[model samples]
Target: MTKLLFLVADGMGDWPVAELGGRTPLEAAPTPNMDALARRCVAGTARTVPQGMAPGSDVANMSLMGFDPAAHHTGRGPIEAAAQGLELDPDDLVWRLNLVRVAGHGPGDAMLDYSSGHIDTGRSTPLVEDLQAHLGDAVFSFVPGIQYRHLLVQRGGARAPEAALDIRPPHDITGQPQGPDLERFASSPRLAELRRAAARRLEAPANTTQANAIWPWGQGRPLLLPAFRQTFGLRGAVVSAVDLVRGLGRASGMEVAEVPGATGLLDTNYQGKVDAALEFLARGGDFVFLHVEAPDECGHSGVTADKVEAVRRFDERIVGPVVRALQGEDAALLLTCDHFTPLARRTHTPDPVPFLLHHPRLADHALPAFSEAGAAATGLTLERGHDLLPHVLERLRG
Candidate 1:
């Protein structure tokens, strides 16, 4: 039987507002189409693993892909770096850099938000080039992305384990405790020294610019793991606009297909995204993971309308096509979010997310159409993220 799993990690905080006390964009927004699908499927909420702790995109995605995050999780820096086309050596260490405004103000002014807001890649690329000139390929190398984001690669030499030592927090946003411990920094020293130097340069009023702010985050390297094909015994593919998701898919022995003309914005190529998934499925992929960034980006900006609109647009454009592809075929379709990117909170919510499964031979067309409110009433009950894969596999067998 052909099996397709269309997973939407609909960005942070995308659940219904009513369910989470009116704090999420997903609740406040209109998603008539998604609501309709929930009606005819086995719907329920799935709790993300490890409980209460804040995990990066890599950990969260690994959980949804049916790998135990605790066992397979390495870090987000490596994942994002990979997505950005940075290669890694087992001896090398990679760190994610954020383009942040290094303001010398009081605690309130100390951190100005909009630090390289959006993918202002134009401003970011120049800043990266400047930094590269300063480093000059010594023990450390600087890699740049759009404004406020970059990657620092440390050449493995005499700095084997020590290369990872003596680092400091890149930003005050995480409220990292004030300390001199190198071990406390997110990444190793080769990258940490470069970050500190860059921050100092940006701290000077003359060096800072509206879109040239620097802030680095999500630090780690490619973790060794059994290929997804070997572990699950299933041929799979991943389609996404996120670099980290794509990089991880590539590392795990799966085809990371690109959606033509896809952009990481509200105006992304939705039809093209669906078409790519269909193509991958036709090419013999039994497991397919699709990612959308609309809701998440809105949450980051705290934009309620954009978040809601993104979700609706995703449903109308992405969902319909995927569902249509599965109809009358010997296949199973499952839908869900990775984590909640609530607009109200402007961060990821620990709340369990709603998911549904539909098999063609099932006896219930009486189920309601997909919607957040209807999913809550499906009587499917809630479980943790780790159980999602097993549950979907069972439905595929039926």
Candidate 2:
């Protein structure tokens, strides 16, 4: 029997009614299919990790993929670097820099639009290519994102773990959170000079990215771990439109299954994703990792209606096909978010995410469709996210 299908929506933060103008996008949205599945399936809130921890891509993803974030965690740069085929030596220091636009001059109001003025690949790609040419060997390469974010892979060899280079992350409504141990690393005089050099190169007029300058952040290296399949004893493949999810698949020693023209939009190839999942099943995959980026994108832009529509589209286009495939099959199914990315908050939230498990022989309960409000009432209440994998494994073993 096949294991299960794991569908994750990354950076899905939570917001209260007042904060979101009387409805969090997930609560306000019409997710008829998801709600229905939740009613009959095991469902409830699950914490991805502890609150007030450093908001990180790798840590969150590690938890979602059924690994302990504390033991298996690494930096986001290593994952992206691996995904892009950049092999790194153990001595190299890497940072994942987002090329964002910086507005205003002074200290506070300087960083513009956290996302580099909502960059598109067309306008931003050339600038990224040009910067690599001018900077030469000191700087490595930049990977344009499926979303507006860009990846800057630096060439820091032989630098001590406590070097002076610092990351300038986005998030200052209250105050910028310091990265774990990065400040101390940035304190050394030699490392500080290197940091200054990197900053100068980024700020220099000679470089023209057309999306403003880069805001370097999330500095760390690879945290190696056993492959997910090896640890869990399940064969899996990841199907995603976004590069980061695909990158995660690569890190976990899984195939990055492609869905043609999957644009990460509500109007993207939804049917195409469904087809991809079926294809993965045909190719002998016991588990499939799927990701949709639209809801998170709309939340980041604070577009409530749009985010709701994205959720609905996932229901009609993606969920239905997956459910249909499960009919009469031995395969089980699981769906949940990586984290909350509320429209009002415009960032990843620490709140528990709603999750569901569906199988043919499970108890009869009717979840109308997928929505935050209904999920609260679903019979299955999980206390933590890590519980999901073992539970699914047990169900599969049955």
Q: Please provide, for model 1 over 29-128, each residue's C-alpha lDDT reduced to its tens digit, 9 standing for 90 to 100.
A: 5656566665566776667655644544566677777767677665556776666656667766676666654343223334445344454666567667
lDDT of 2: 0.64
- Candidate with top TM-score is 2
Considering every candidate listed, which one attains the maximal lDDT? 2
User: Which residue runs does candidate 2 get wrong by more than 4 Å?
Assistant: 18-21, 138-147, 156-168, 171-210, 377-383
Runs of candidate 1 exceeding 4 Å displacement: 12-24, 84-86, 105-108, 146-148, 156-193, 200-209, 363-383
Question: How big is the positional error of residue 122 in model 2, measured in Å on the Cα after superposition?
Answer: 3.7
Q: Among all windows of ten consecutive residues in candidate 1, which has the lowest summed lDDT?
A: 169-178
lDDT of each: 0.63, 0.64
lDDT of 2 by residue, 181-286 (tens): 2344346554444444545555657655534545555555654656978878888888887665676778789888777777766667878777887888888888
Instruction: Rate residue 332 of model 2 by lDDT.
Output: 71
Clashes of each: 34, 25
